[model samples]
Target: MVNATQVSFFTLSAYFDTGVFKYLYFIIIVSLYIVIICANLLLIVVICMNRSLHEPMYLFLVSLFVNELYGSTGLFPFLLVQILSDIHTVSAPFCFLQIYCVFAYAAIQFHNLSILSYDRYLAICYPLQYNTRMTSNKVSVLIALIWLFPFLAIAVLISLSVPLQLCGNIINTIYCDNYSIVKLACSDTRVNNIYGLIYTCLIVFGPLSLILYTYMKILKVCFSGSKQTRQKAVRTCTPHLASLINFSFGCLFQILQSRFDMSSVPMMLRNILSLYFLTCQPIFNPLMYGLQMSKIRSLCKSIIFGKTLTDA
Candidate 1:
């Protein structure tokens, strides 16, 4: 039987031997990172600088952008470095930190979407109470809890990972995922897997179900109103609904694949889907809001021209 020490050593050795393909993958990933950073930064700037965008919905959007920025930053740079360099190794402490950040950001994202859905639900179903219930203080507290709760969960998960002895050399995916890393262990992973599944279901599916149910109710409320009110409600909820759907779907595929064994899928196919999920959301978000919401498009254009005029 492969012992813990052997597993760790073997995994490290195999990781270092990945050749030219790693560098090529790194370049592609870096390009995607640049796009995600620039797009999200622009979105944040537009929301902040435009007085018109200083409303509840846009405020929630800014929060989403912030979450995505941290999420991508936490996961991508480390993967890029590993791909580009011969040093495909991470210390146990750093590994834990990485896992913590990745999972924390993911949880924050899940909660953010759920919050946004609830926000829309109130806006559509109880317009008069929306402002009072979703007061600035309330929103702030919710956002804080969303970020903080995830870190606590991650701490517990990391503790579970510490006792296991890892003895593998190959990471099947591009990055150091929790399951992928845990699989390297010589210890029985049944408990870890079970706990991981529970965590994922709570973090991913729980929020997702809430979002879906809230939106369904919101839609019913919309239809119950007059044509004008219905149209207005639909307009308000559409962007959020689209974004929520995209985020949930992307996360579902990413998380499920990350948790389960991926031995059956070809490496190339796995890499492609991984890249799609990782790169697509950040890029897709701004475009979706920009094209679908006229106010955002106007703000973006105004900012571009205003910058040009200032520079000239």
Candidate 2:
């Protein structure tokens, strides 16, 4: 019965009364949030403070890690608050804000990964020319573009969504989702849908295409080159490839759960699946990169434990 303009808050029906179990949930989520923050921040610090880690690859990683922190912060605190509250309601403006944050986070992640792939492509395929192509200034600009493009793109999406006349105020999920809000609109949404499609092509498929192309090129180089070259490619590219695959799969899960009929599935499992990308990706990237990248692992050990192990 509520109009979109008049709707002050939206009900999130995903949450249920878990009684004392809420406390357990709260502890678990809070612990997760803390871990995400600390892990990402630790890597960021390790990258920034060490001059040895100031190369293009590590710089790109800093951007990626910072994004993990940004994306997780956008979701975890709000989720924590909602978990403890009896009524799961979020203000309209705040909901849209969350949508913006979440969307931008996703966009930035894809773009960042794309650029990282490009960096790898340069490093592996054209090692002699990498310094010339991926200069510090260029790296700075690429970093700027990754962050700027997503924030601006999501802003337009929010602007489009905010003016819609919604038929309902209830969001079925725990978090504010742009597609869900657009679906609630009683007003004409053709423009929104069109723009959304365009944004997806640009933000999602565009980067994915670039990533695929770069990897194929990298693979070609590895096959044609020496064993040392193959080892080098594997050493540098494995973590990035793993991170991309993991995040992409997580995104796929979220998309399937959101766009399709999942009512037959258990609600608890649905909630976990919905949150998988946001929760897992943040922690996943740091661990994958931290352990897999020898330089970072050695540097971390040196910083944490008073023993400076040489990079293997």
Candidate 3:
């Protein structure tokens, strides 16, 4: 174990003996990264170029897509390089940076979904106020908060983490997660552990409760309210619900992986489960929103078939 001041690198524990599959892994990961970029960027471009798609819902979607890009980028670039090379090592600074990006990305998803729940709540539960409540300025401010709050929350965790004297230089996982680094610290980590739990509760349950309540109200309205209201809710809420479910599964898988000893599981399965959240969400979210929402779908189709993307 190197002293905190002297330790400059960390070796990931999850880089298994792929042997001949290194090249194959490299090709697959590169292909996935490219698809993630293209899928998300296409949807983002469609949203930004068309003024008609500019609203609280679409704006929130743009933020979600941006999260996918930010989150995926934090992983894929480094992953691709590592796959091509023999080194399975990362510098302390880069490791910490990845931790920040990945943590912030995960935390912000909860907030984004929470804000979206509120947005949907207003739009469906209180239509007249929706216009006033979800104005351009409000949406912009909320978007800023969605990004800012998570950064600051995780920033505090990372700040506490920076001063820790690590007991080991190897991370058990493929990526630099907050808990993985904290686990390696030789210092008394009661404070970090407690704080991490509280933060997790706040990030997870707070948004989850809000999302459930909002959706519950939306559901009641769907059952009791007019036909038009039910149809509208179905159209708007479906993608958000789908995205939420997908993200929740990823979060659940991550929690289970971190909390339990999964070494007995097959190595390939373990890697796939651990990395699913980081990789799959990035690919799935863009498709969830792009294809499910008719307007964006039409815009994407037009851009593809009409070849009028240059104007966009």
Which candidate ranks first by TM-score, i.e. highest? 2
Candidate 1 vs candidate 3, TM-score winner: 3
lDDT of each: 0.74, 0.91, 0.86
* Each prediction's TM-score versus the true structure: 0.85, 0.97, 0.95
> How many clashing residue pairs are found in candidate 2?
0
Clash pairs detected, candidate 2 = none
Candidate 2 ranges beyond 4 A from true positions: 307-312
Q: Can you rank all candidates by TM-score, best first?
A: 2, 3, 1
Worst lDDT 10-window in candidate 3: 303-312
40-130 per-residue lDDT for model 3 (tens digits): 8999999999888888888898898899899999999898887766778999999889989988999898889888988998999999888
Tell me model 1's lDDT, rounded to 2 decimals. 0.74
lDDT of 3 at 225: 94
The regions of model 1 sitting more than 4 angstroms off are 1-26, 188-191, 259-261, 307-312
Task: List where candidate 3 sits over 4 angstroms from the true fold.
Answer: 309-312
Clashing pairs in 3: none
lDDT of 1 by residue, 240-280 (tens): 77777776677666666777776687666666676554567
What is the alpha-carbon lDDT of model 2 when measured against the actual structure?
A: 0.91
Which clashing pairs does model 1 show? 7-167, 7-168, 8-167, 11-168, 11-169
User: What's the true lDDT of residue 150 in model 3?
Assistant: 88
